[model samples]
Target: MANATRSGNYPPLKNTEHDHAIGPLRTVELHPERRRNTRRFGICGRIAAYLMSIALAAALLPTPIGSETAHANGACRTDDHGIRLTADATGESPHFTSIQFLSASTGRAAGNGFMLGTSDAGCRWQPIYRGKLTFAQMDFVTNSLGYVLAGTSPEGPAMLLRTANGGSSYSPVPNGGNRFARIDFRTATEGFGFTFNDSGAHYTANGGAKWSKLPTPPNTRGLRFFTLEDGWAVTLAPGGYLVKRTTDGGRTWTTRLKASSAVGVGGAVYGAGGRDVWVLLYGGSGMSQTSYSLFHTKDGGASWKQVVSNATAGGGPAPGPAVKAGKLPGPAGRPADMATPDSRAAYLLAGSGAMDKLSLGRTMNGGKTWRNGAAAPGFEGKLTFPAAKSGWLAVTSLTSPAVYATRDGGATWSKTFAIPAD
Candidate 1:
């Protein structure tokens, strides 16, 4: 059933009518004339928002932002040392997809026309809220408190916003009709969210006001919780399904491991601390090729292993043919599908139709072996680092959508903005 939209919300036209029809609804109606020409370029837009806030003030100024003065307001790029900024929460252009940071100056960014903030990090990006939804996901545990998760429109009601001050202002965390796809918080009260159908899982210890539903195990699609007890949940059954665990926060949950019936776990599930976790499976279902696995566990969820396996496994990369030049393959064609770690080193973005690849794997000698770095440009959606050497790697371009950055971790990259081909 799980598919309603007559006011029950959950209708972003069934996921934006196949590829965001009409460019994210005309970029959310030209975002108030692009915020009145960025406040009439007041003081040169405040010196380009203070040189893009020196790349989130680089963990407290140790001297960064040098790579020919970092620049790319369209097709993103920033890595001469790394520091690229672009937030167009609806200013006619600059459509930041998803970004989150609790430090490095404080951060928050959502796309399609509203939800921006920057305590001095990205130089200056102001806008606290705007309705009509399109926020994909965001989570912060301190700095003030956070949560975003949006995609509403059966009429309304499918949000989850919350901010205790760090974001300036944000409220609305009722969500009884349940439609969240991803959300994870470890402190600031306690958190965990999931609902793609298989209908189960949702909890709040006070930060979200009130919520409770935990049980999830029936056809569970995907979920990853880092704290609030530990966290983990996966179920689809093709080979590996069901891996629930809760130290004690969720009250009770225990099932350790069960992933290896033969291999066929979908996609999306990430973690960094709380024992370092990661999951990305694809074999069929528009993911083309056939094989692409990367499962790792440090102990939190008891156990799990299968470091890395790529080549689409037999059902992942198939649409190849129109590469008159080179590089192009993301948008589910295969290659832009994993990002979920705050440290322990983790960053993988691959797409091959138009060519966009970047990988920087590190397990601190834990996940066994995974070492590869250098490659960027060709994104699918969602990849915000914030710190760990700088972040922001959004890319979804059929014609215009870009963002990139890497300090010295992924090697060398540049280009930091682009979303105007209209």
Candidate 2:
């Protein structure tokens, strides 16, 4: 459990080496862009997971100008990450994917069908439930109580919703035909649901209505569970991609690490417990040489290292003081979005890089050391911090829907509304 420690990558100094008048490179890197279920890896793997979720949601869309989004006139200075995060409230269909926050006041944002919320730290936002369901999974352990999982299609009637006052209203847990691609609940009724491509991950003690089948390890994408027995999952095999753990709820499992320098893996996997886990692995040499890094695990997730890196697979982990792969822009400088509330304060987002701007990185004392934060625009999704100053950043592209807030942990951010229309 101690055989990883390599680090190298600090590159970022092109485009005429800055000074194009003074500022224009906010840790640029954007373009780099999940899970599981039941026991039916059948019907041709559910028609190849419904054509791989329409090419994996178009390969997880969002590559507009620099990747999450870009477009600013400019104003707020002091290292203007691009002066983003705006809204009196407007949306034709800007779009949002998923966002969750049970504290730092409260939170919710779901994609497509629209769901909205906030409670103070975010200034003031309302509207709780609106329908047709386009959510991909929303969670809450407090702030009223919550759980959502609508937006389904892969041959079956899927829907799982429940709200105890927060979302204002919701009721649908007849999740019997379970088409779960992702779901989690350590309480609020003790729950868990998963799928990497077709139905086969379950364990529900009532809150989710009903479910059973559990034992899974093959290709499971991001099955979470922080307590009620502990949990974690991530696998791809065939030459590297594993990461597993289970304390009892999932029956039995262990593996904890094996990225093999990864080529892809993104959706959701971050932690502040169980030895403090975190995951973000992506690599590319085609489509214009992309890159990404940031892996860590204390002892519960077996073994891992590479606290952060850029391209060329960068040396092996834990070496520090490195950067260069276009000199940190994002979209390839990869740090799409991340937030850790413990193990020593954390938050990272470099979305819309390549020049559109938006870079915010902070680490109180965890990832060695980092600073430069405060920027906004969109593209970053789900970055929550329930305390330690309080945080929340959930944005979607096409014009950057909205939902941002930070009391101090993330330097600064505001918005906290807009995202309802279409």
lDDT for each residue of candidate 2 in 56-160, tens digit (9 for 90 to 100): 223222233322222244222122122222221232343666787666554666665555654433443434444445666687666566677764332334467
- Computed on alpha carbons, the lDDT of every model, listed in order, comes to 0.50, 0.54
Q: How well does each candidate superpose onto the true structure, as a TM-score? A: 0.30, 0.29
Cα lDDT over the full model 2 = 0.54
lDDT (10s digit) by residue, model 1, range 244-347? 65666556667655544344444556767466676655545333333455555656645455444443334543221111111211222354645544535565
Q: Which stretches of candidate 2 lie over 4 Å from their true place?
A: 1-126, 129-168, 174-210, 216-254, 257-303, 306-369, 372-411, 415-422
